[model samples]
Target: MPDLSHPAAHRPGHGDPDWAAMRRILVVRPDNVGDVLMTGPVFRALRAAAPRAALDLLASPAGAAAASLLPQVDGVVTASVSWQQLDLVPGSDPDAELVGDLAARGYDAAIVLTSFSQSPWPAAEVARRAGVPVRVGLSKEFGGGLLTHWVPSPPDEEHQVDRMLGLLAAVGVPSRGIALEVRVPDDAATPLAVVGERYAVVAPGASCPSRRWPAERFAAVVRALAGDGLTVVVSGTERESDLVHAVAGDVGVPLAGGLGLADLASLLAGAEVVVANNSGGVHLADAVGAPVVELFAGTETVDQYRPRTTRAEVLTRPVSCAPCRQLVCPFGQECLAISPDEVVAAARRLRAVHV
Candidate 1:
């Protein structure tokens, strides 16, 4: 029942800024590629409502790649802010460097986007320190005056796409719809040479261990898809080469490593169907309008992460500890114990509907 009521209903001070007058805007989404892709609608709305303004993205390294595919984004500034999980330390004072870079960009306004588990205040503070006067963010906790326009966070059960659109609506920027979009840059040629003209993609890797489906199960799905007269390709990051290999087996082509974001977008865009775990691949496939069959884990609410596209089907089992939000599942990942048969069926069902 919790909803993103209105910013006016919760905002402490200052009226809505003149979005039209703003020349440069900074959108902060310092998260994974999936999270950035999920915010595509926000970027879309901003671009439509303020077409004259330059929309820039402040993102992590992984997120920067996704931002580049968004036509709405005029520029992308990559950094690992203090609030984010630091995989590798870039410099001694990365935070200061980020603030300085943002200040130099002369962003007239800033919009901070975050998942339910993350706090927007940290990113909002970066905007404030960078002299971005018009800062907007959604927060369940007090922002301590960091945000110029603060909208209350929506409920946990709210779909992430809807939640972000609601945040924009609260600040006078209406949604252009919840469709996720990614463009294949001219440089990233379609990778159809690696696989047949008609192929299915099996992306079997996730950043979190809890969110991954069993490699053997993915291998089973690959075999099933191959039997259905579709060429199967298993895709993953360079680090996940072993996992991708295990899932590909003999039936599927292993396309681990060395794929840029735009290239991956092109590959998924050409897929007949994409089967993936709850990872960036799911979002990428959805963004490219590829039908997806997702083996979703219970670490997060299914409603929160499920693809917005009706062309997708998500499979999950109920568990008491679901929505645990754990990087590592203490429970044996019982929530993701879906069989390959169900996944194969879902894939066929989606393809039938679309075809």
Candidate 2:
């Protein structure tokens, strides 16, 4: 696919210098919230290496909110480019103004983060046009002379958090840690007081339908968990209210729209165990140090995208058509054919790990 209407015209390769020499750094991850959250370790390494330098993020609207939760970030600039977002309308060159604006800032170096499925060259072009001295990211095809530091991000990935940390390794800055992190705002209130103390939070929403398990199966898990004497809380964005309501039923507390992203995180932080689809909730729970049982949809390989936290378990039924990564499943969704009993058992295993 063509990338953001910008050709790889800029020449690549630059001499590496100590982290102390770079003044202002711009990090770009133009995707959803979970993708941005995965980059937290990269931002932390950059901050620890150059404490005096300003660190800025160029993110989509969804990514900027998640990026803000990382304390290491100094500023956020939201721009939805053609390559990163599926819904947005694009111009002749959607990145022209952004490139000019970024250039005016005189950032010393720019690091563009892209998924294995996406190309970093689009963002790299923006950095090059902005006159950034050094640019970095992974390359599958030839670099097209658009990157200064080329980091290797495998097509079928490893843990996303560690993969992001690998980008820092390209710059000679040692990675601090591989743990995924999110700074839940102190002002986050308890939106669902009914959840009380020890409860299992069930997040049923995934960004794409293919990544989500069947709603009926999730409801069954909630009922089974409740039967085990554990209180259940169902969480989702407003868009998934119907799905949340159906899953919550009369037994679980539906915390849809009642909680902001930070508030939802607080709820997850307090949970004894988080039962959710393989989505942002998994990452959020991991960030808050809560164990999670992921109802994974095997639309893609689990090896690369599974929960990055220590205490987590994934439940998926393998199929030949899996790892197709289709938004709309053409093969009857064999990945989510797992039973409710299996999910409850997976949750039990993850809980045992924490105990």
Alpha carbon lDDT of each predicted model: 0.87, 0.80
lDDT of model number 2: 0.80
Which candidate has the top score in TM-score? 1
TM-score of 2: 0.91
Question: Where does the lowest 10-residue lDDT sum fall in candidate 1?
Answer: 2-11
Q: Give the per-residue lDDT digits (tens) of candidate 2, residues 1-355.
A: 3343223322344545467877899988877877777888898899888787899999888877787688799888888776765565545777788988898888998888876677888788888888997888876666676777766554445666666777677667789887888888889886546877768899989988888888898899999888877789998888889999999998988877767778878888888789887777788787888998887787767887777655888888988887787887777778888888988998877666665
Model 2 Cα RMSD, 1 decimal: 4.1
Off by over 4 Å in 1: 1-9, 86-94
Candidate 1 local lDDT, 1-355, one digit each (tens): 5464553535556677788888999988878999998888898999887878999988888788888888788999999788875564675555889999999999999998877888888888888889999998888777568888888888878899898888889889988999988877878966677787989999999988999999999999999999999889899989999998999998899988888888899988888899999999999888889999998999889998889764889999999998888999997899998988999999998878766
